[model samples]
Target: MAVISNSLQIKHGLSLWCPQSASINRTHRRSSIGLGRVLRRSYVAASSAFANENREFVIVGGGNAAGYAARTFVEHGMADGRLCIVSKEAYAPYERPALTKAYLFPLDKKPARLPGFHTCVGSGGERQTADWYKEKGIEMFYEDPVTSIDIEKQTLTTNSGKQLKYGSLIIATGCTASRFPEKIGGNLPGVHYIRDVADANLLVSSLERAWKVVIVGGGYIGMEVAAAAVGWKLDTTIIFPENHLLQRLFTPSLSRRYEELYQENGVKFLKGASIKNLEAGSDGRVTAVKLEDGSNIEADTVIIGIGAKPAVSPFESVGLNTSVGGIQVDGQFRTSIPGIFAVGDVAAFPLKMYDRIARVEHVDHARRSAQHCIKALLSAQTHTYDYLPYFYSRVFEYEGSPRKIWWQFFGDNVGETIEIGDFDPKIATFWIESGKLKGVLVESGSTEDFQLLPKLARSQPFVDKAKLQNASSVEEALDIARASLTS
Candidate 1:
């Protein structure tokens, strides 16, 4: 039997066909091998594409916003991909506010140190272990700093030269403490800024050995730190350039209230003061701080809780617009850059009620913002981030007396704050606006009032201001508020 073969070739303007015999078998074998190689390449390409398709949602920063975002996404069934959270810190995301208060207290009082099963404990116990993220199928890259973002290419490059592609990206980068320049001895071993768990730990360690601690900045952070230090029986003094604490955020009267709280707890206040120079010992530990008033205060440790600047460098590098030291996002938490969203302390969002853009660093804000972002991501709906801001700080006493609690609320169009339950000038005050309950200032009078404030704030149609103030007891006031809201 004779085998027949045909060779066909086509050129620019010509075609040729030749019939052959012996070469046909060899040609057929080569063609089969070539086809197999093409198929294999296609299969491998498809596999690569599949792997890329399964790439997780990438979130920068492992703070409250990032953790809340991860949890929200998982709860909404949007936790596909790897849900990678890259944090510069080695530990998982922990409660930051608690760091300055509870964590600084004795082990028994610190929530993180409590041994029993607590609902607040994430996948692992406190201290933000990675297992929490792992439990939610989230991947964490700790101690990894994202250096640059390639927006056009949808890629991020780390400082270590690693590149990651993201299907969706969230810039919850949070913020960093505003440090004084090294020339002013800001970088000294004894000078510390509180922004993370590590900083708190360092401060705690320093407090152990120090006899006197001077905290610069009379903002909430500094005041909270002072309260914590004083609670631990340390001689602590707070230096505030302003006449009051949280002057930037609250009215003079409110700030004065905070000042009084700290003072009552045996924390010294140096208002309208500045640090002239940090006197150091031979061992490089801060021995004292020279004040601008020509008076030198002995300071074993100096904590600078001056303020914070948004951690928006990565987003800025990607050409995402920012304002008020935070990434500007639209109603849906979508940044000016497409495929990117931001939230928490690092996101400047429009406040319809206040008719301005506001950025709050409270945990509630972080949680609500993350929830809004997650809802938007899942439903593809456009919802404005318009939750009212609320925050609280724990006040501890130097003596054996009970720790006082202070809380504030800011409202718009709400009317007349009502005072109830003895209206102790040193304890608590309720702010009622427009016949509606608005703000509650609590020191030690009622825990119920503190808990009820947030609920009423959200429920709107707040408590009956008249009835609340006229009520004989906190329980009566709460019942009136609940009834008013329901009615």
Candidate 2:
């Protein structure tokens, strides 16, 4: 099996999320592994025996999209043993976000584990365990990832030499972490990345043995893991080239709020810093992180969370949205090639609300796009992917925290930002563009409170500038926006 260089290849069993400008604004997204030598060995032994098998529906990814699509298939009564899922991971699709959040909680907290966090559960549905797949008569090939495809023949081959001809295919292979090249010690022992459950498991072991921790790149992975590191009482420091955290989304004031919380919780920041290389100890474990400025920070564990890239290596015939780094798909998630639909983080579909083709690298989109694609496949009506771009996180949810920080955003962040709340019990930020509400971000809000934000973002309601200008509280602001909608 050939390798895709310079990325953390968990060979993601589906290794996915949705598209967000190739790297999900430098990764609220990532994971995927390349087919490896061991799998290739199995190909020789199994190729002849498993050759020329066929399935009516084949999902090439075992990530969020695959799991939700499987559920949809079951719902639509189409998964009658004719549907199959091929995954690189050993387990069925569980909630991938748990790998970043609860999976990293201190061992004493008894963090989340497989079977508990499986797909659909994250969004309040049935827990689809491996047994569920079997009971539903859904064929699953674990640790046997599809390695190559023949578009003309409508067949795909797996690493274990299973040949599968599909009447229709869904590409859900997600994305892989963008890492520092090995030339600079990116692959050092103490250095870690989180793209899959396997990657998180490795990082957990490293975190246990670690004291001083250095996290590179302050994207989703960086921020989330740093909180985990701080929770473990390790000396944690996050260094990034950006001036503040979540540069692509958070306004300075908003960033300051979260940064303050992290600092109060013992996470340090070294903003505007660039990485030179990682220095490893004699035992071949990383010991320190060196910056381009010739300064070095001593460390026991180093995690890289720069960004992610889509895993579309095997399907060259599928058209690509080169601008965003994904398989190009229409509103219905139909790819450039017929019968091969792409969803989850791998499909760059038209964002109807934004009137542009964009890829989302988030779980919500992965689940929604997959369901919509399956519905489109089964139905004759033309359907469009109308997704409200959203991103969110909650850090330090474990016990003994000064405060637990959580936030959720809806719609685009491309405009002027207005903020409310003081980041004590809560905070809300709104972005208005072209005299309409374009985006909303809220921290620590109730379910009912959150319901309004997505609506405001979607409707793009005209603003009452003076009313908003005088608004002092989130409720006041909400009322103002509500009145604007009615007006």
Candidate 3:
């Protein structure tokens, strides 16, 4: 077949089809080839016309969203349609959140492995394995990523030269971790990132011999890694340009509360400082980290968690509407193109509750958005995606302490004024704008209390400043808000 920059195809006259020769046997054969080899060596010679004639549905990613979409499809009586999932990952969709948390837990804690953290299981559903796919007549293309897509032609070409056409497509490409320039020692042997299971495994292995570890960025990933490192008895230091942890999200009081807790756990913090360059030994392994403030700290391992950017290359050649965040999707998770949908971190969707468009990178969003997209596809439903913004972070626990510092936030945290309830073991903040409650945040709150906060925020109840100032507890404020709805 002719290739145009390994992406576009100018052969408009070509028809679409999917030959039965590409189907796997019912015996469930597993390929032993490594992902790198499969992408480079294994080739599938199918034309776009052949694929289109056969395929009914196709998903372009293998993360949380893809996994849930598969479950949604099968649940909705889609047992026999030709469904295919193309993914660069060798493993099936597993819990992406565990990589930065439980997967890094001490060996005694027994970190999760394949089949354990698989999709649908996170949402109390069945774990669909390779055998499950076979039983359902679904085909999976692992380690072979789609290098290009022809939207008008409804075709996808993988890195291995396999081509397929679909009646409907779901894009769940997820996001990529951010790193520093290679000139600054970002490519050193001990430098690490945690975006997938492979990255977490590598970092976990490094922790066994790591004494002094440097963590970059103050985002939840950096904070969580620091908590785990110190919990494992390693010397951990966090460096970020922000004056406090979670500077972009948490207020000064909440940041200080968590920062103090981290310090109490013996984790050092180097705030308001950026990495000048990484120092390495003759062997090219990192040895130390130099800060922009003219200070150097010993580092046996380094973890970078600066941020993430949407994985949008597969959609680039398709001329889809995109923003700096990700592919812009409607309330139903449909893209600008017909019969196409985008979800999870790669989709910048409209947040109806906030009357604004935003993209969330959390696992909850991934699971819900995928389910919504599948509903819209299978039923032609015009349901509006009204998702309440929610996120949480769990940090360190000292020796002999069974307590874990965890916090969950719901609704929008942006407002003209903020009110606090308490800041000890429990930290609660309410964001108010023009006497209207806009958001609620709480740390170490009970399940009932946490659940009530979001409902109150969604109600957008009118508030009196005097009642907020005189409120004894979060529960009291919740009671007042609840009464307002009734009154």
Candidate 4:
């Protein structure tokens, strides 16, 4: 490799490095090029470009977690000076959840846009935009991914050949969507995965002419995309290896409810089946799907929402402690390497409430954990992160019956029995273990229900079946349940 020093300007910041000059001394400071005398000068005072390259806080990845952490740093008066966010994406952090929801809608549907769904806003806070970053003196290295990191050296090198040294580092690289192997026709055209805005845009663009669409893996992404497909008046078919949709999380009864609704909306389901290979047309686009059982189904478009894997390639040589899912972190979001922290879907942290390690892949966890990590770094607080796991989904218009469902759930669902509430306009399911509440799931609940149900679930109050059965409302039921625990 050729060795040369050149001044490379970092976007939205200062020069990433000192200019190549023989006059520069070992300290990278300026020295007079003369045989008679030598004068020394600081790089910051000599070069305007050199002052911008170094960062006090360097965060990898520009997703929700990184965005929130930056916002937290700013909120706590760390806004100016050396804060740099290196991201592979061209744009800064936005609402990634929108990629599957409103973003896939038709043009007339008025979908979400940048600066609208920015970080902190997703958590009901202020929107931090490019202008905000410029005003706050934060540097963003967009479209330039950090290719290597050396914890011992306290530095990282980006793909653009720019080296950034950090006093503190935060790893929030997030996750990547898993695609089928190329040998199995995954490389064929008309196949897509929705992980970023570009992916969503491609899928949405294809929907204009795609009438028959086959969706593989019936997880949340698949189910949500299926809803969007149905709205587009396409013939949608969802295939998965599981017996029911979200089989790992939703109970059979709840799964049936969602499955029935989808079926009623003209969506086809192929459960307990696996894709053998994709059949392609002469144009090198997927034309049909072949099942392992030797069955074939015609398809104009294919979507694989199998799952996501943490983007941890850069850390392979770094030797940070990582689990199969993500980087293993303590309650405070600190990884095995001190001064280096991990958050969001890329972090597998110990769940204090459950006393088990959990790597949650959800928006709520991402936002909270990012803040937690920053708070710990700032205050040096030793408080364990006690966060309640929460997840939700939004689906609208099923079978033209004006179907709309907004559901939220808290805690683990494993239990000996379940208590079901009225399943009409509102549905609630409580998981009970040893006569104590372990989890709560409520759909279309009243304001009071959202406010109290989680507290009740967290407290794990003992339940009185007679009182709970007689209670008419969620609040009333919770009150009666709490009384039993206290009494």
Candidate 5:
């Protein structure tokens, strides 16, 4: 709530808002030892008098990871005035994925709203609202983000000039949405970017009055917004530098299928486009998008969804994984500093299943890593973090569409791809390397079919490309992949 001159502008909850592939770096694995000895120091340490009140567990972010971490602490019988959450937003942590998904749906669709989509609920757990934290004895510091973190002394100072020390610290500060420099009208009134509930609220206000919507990225944010814009009956156009959408994940064929679907729903596309600058009207709001090719698209609202990077400014002195763009942590989410931990998009931890260090930007990793970190901290879990990359989205429900526009992908999207299905009722894409299934993506899959991808991808089953490609339906193809795990 207090604005200060000496504070880092590290945005919170951006990952849970955007939840896209911001940056992914695969590196050598790491080893962790002596965690128990270090964490046993407790809140009553040598520097106990540094702060008026020291919490045993202080989570620096109130995003999905922070909210879930609080729930995990309460579940483990640890929330007896020993846990606290410091957040940059006035509201407590809620499910951020809704900002682009159900939150953007047409008003008639009864889109998701606050108090109903808080953390843990996104993962089928209990909803932990603001009052829930009070009921469970968890301290809440809303709208006060920690600006400075002292790793050696194990203390952090908030922007409101509040000093707090922690026995065990969680640096869950998620990410910040990437934006254009203000020289190019990036700061124009109608040129918007969504990274939290506040950002979404402003965008919703713009949408209510806008006649045309211009989305300036092909990734998750642009695609999802495009779908929502069409639903609202606005003139929607998606412009991106890539030849196809979701360039990071979708195969050419896979991208084509979704592009066709979007086209059928009245969304326009200007693929492989480069933006020169945003043109502002006399009223000082974004009015048009100028392209490098001497073309201009008139627009009343612009949504920027280029990408995001980890919000790790306050803790950079603690030796982060610079190559991976986040705080470096071991499998147990322990930073180089003994009593500190990092989770969610900000922690570049070892992905044991892949034998490489990766910083995953997704809700699933956020929920699982928070629970795993707390368990490891409480001495209930011993194993390292073994995570398989998973991403999924469901968009578009127009007047005549009965088919569910949904897809789930598991594992890495490397290696040669095999695009299957008829695209009429189903579409499946498999990534194969050395005749083994490395990843699987399927649209309009069944409940049973969706369950097989994680299993098949983790096992990396040796598969026959011909057998999989020739399978009749999504169920049949996934059935073949499921069998290959044992064969």
Candidate 6:
């Protein structure tokens, strides 16, 4: 049986992984291992067999989590022919968030774009280049997908019939967008879903000739696309089945505020409505979308952003446990089968911070969890992962501001929200909960707010609710929070 650690970090800076009693028992058992020499030798033989079969740690994805893990493993003296990354995509890992803004903007004043597989400077400024990975001695197998995993033999077969063995495996395969139901005419040419850079490129190509674009689902992706379309002076309509935008995330009041912001930017919204069927023109392009209420809206293009389903089919036949469409892992990122681990959007683990089962899709969560997994791989022991949830998005102006600002955090359970800068039309709201700062949402605040909020959220014991609400500035809020924690 695999040993699992039960630990939770509480007050003070110290981390508690296992109980003191349990540690003492483990130590005592190690000292009395004279009678278990035969069992120990057998275990050593099995481990040695695994080590000889595959000298390198094989990672089965090329995303942020996989890149970070590869770096972390190498940095910790695990290098020397001991690490390889296999990514199905042709390009190396690159940031996906900026594809809508920086990549699509004009040359002279474009935002910072993500680095691609090859270093080609577009209109945007210089980002981190992919060649840096090769410089660091990392081996990458691009466009190679592992089709099957032989768990007992610790071997993997790729789509190209290349077979490789591994002592340990890390699955970082992320999710894909949920497809429209088959009966609703989803196979239409002009209907598309955004999941990767390729999808974004296709949408941009379609937008060139699209007179009107209809987006299904009012989540962040849909809203961000709507904002971009409105910025480009395109006819954009957002159809949401929910009555309010971002209903699943924020309060109705906040959703209304966002609705007003979008409306001011000339983006039309269709609330409490669902698409019944899509109609294609004679040219084999989408011409209109028929609503469940029997109403039809003209459209040249339709983008589906309804959300994602876990990319877990590759691991399903291997008998890996999963919950809610993601692979299940323990605190140490270890799957049900030993020597195999998983992380990022694909791993469903119990969240110590939220006190619930969670599968986070944010960059910060992926990085932190990957770090913990690397630490576990090194020590060969269970390590508890504890990190605060963080997320952000770029939205339209608060009032009539021409500048673009960011909204960092939004959640109802978080206590009073404090705002800074011009709160009139442009505003920044910081959510505080239980005398601790939880998150911040910026509409027209400085980019510095994004850099500082995540750190403040992690270092707990936030400010008092009353003090935070009445604070004059961010500096004052920080001071008050510090004082409250110490007091």
lDDT of 3 by residue, 1-487 (tens): 0010111111111111101001111111112321222111112224645733446778889899998988888888874556888898888887788788777877766656777888878878888777787788878899999898876566788999987877677889888887878999998999998888788889999998888999998877888888888768889999999889876667887788888888887889998897899999988899999988788999989999888877888796433333335776677776655566788888767677765566778888899999988887677565688987777776554344445887777766666645456556576777777788877777788888777877877888887767876778767766776676666
lDDT of each: 0.63, 0.79, 0.74, 0.73, 0.79, 0.63
lDDT of 5 by residue, 67-136 (tens): 8888889988988688989999888888888888778776777877899899888888888888899999
Q: Where in model 3 is the C-alpha error above 4 Å? A: 1-53, 79-81, 319-323, 397-402, 416-422
Candidate 1 residue 355 Cα shift, in angstroms, is: 3.2
Candidate 4 — what's its lDDT? 0.73
Model 1: residue 55 alpha-carbon error in angstroms: 2.6
TM-score of candidate 4 against the unseen true structure? 0.86
Query: Which window of 10 residues has the lowest lDDT sum in candidate 2?
Result: 20-29
RMSD of 2: 8.9
By descending TM-score, how would the candidates be arranged?
5, 2, 3, 4, 6, 1
Rate residue 419 of model 6 by lDDT: 59
What candidate 2 gets wrong by more than 4 Å, as runs, is 1-52
Alpha-carbon error at 130 in model 5, in Å? 0.5
Of candidates 6 and 5, the better by lDDT:
5
Error of 3 at 422 (Å): 4.2
lDDT of 4 by residue, 276-387 (tens): 9999999889999999999998999999988887788787643333333577666787664546778888876667777666667777878889998888777646577887
Candidate scoring better on lDDT of 4 and 6: 4
Which of the two candidates, 2 or 3, achieves a greater lDDT against the reference? 2
RMSD of 4: 11.3
TM-score of 3: 0.86
Candidate 6 global TM-score: 0.78
1-487, model 6: which lDDT tens digit per residue?
0001111111112121211101101221111313322111011223443455453577888766776676677668775466778888777765555555444442334434445422212213233245656666667788888888876666778888777676677888876677887577676888887766677777777776678989888876787777766655678899989889765455466677778777887789999997899998898778998999999989988888777766776787533333334677666676655567788878766667655556666655666777688777775555477656656676442333364646665322356656553444455466666656666555544555456655556655546677767877655655565565456
TM-score of each model, paired residue for residue: 0.77, 0.89, 0.86, 0.86, 0.90, 0.78
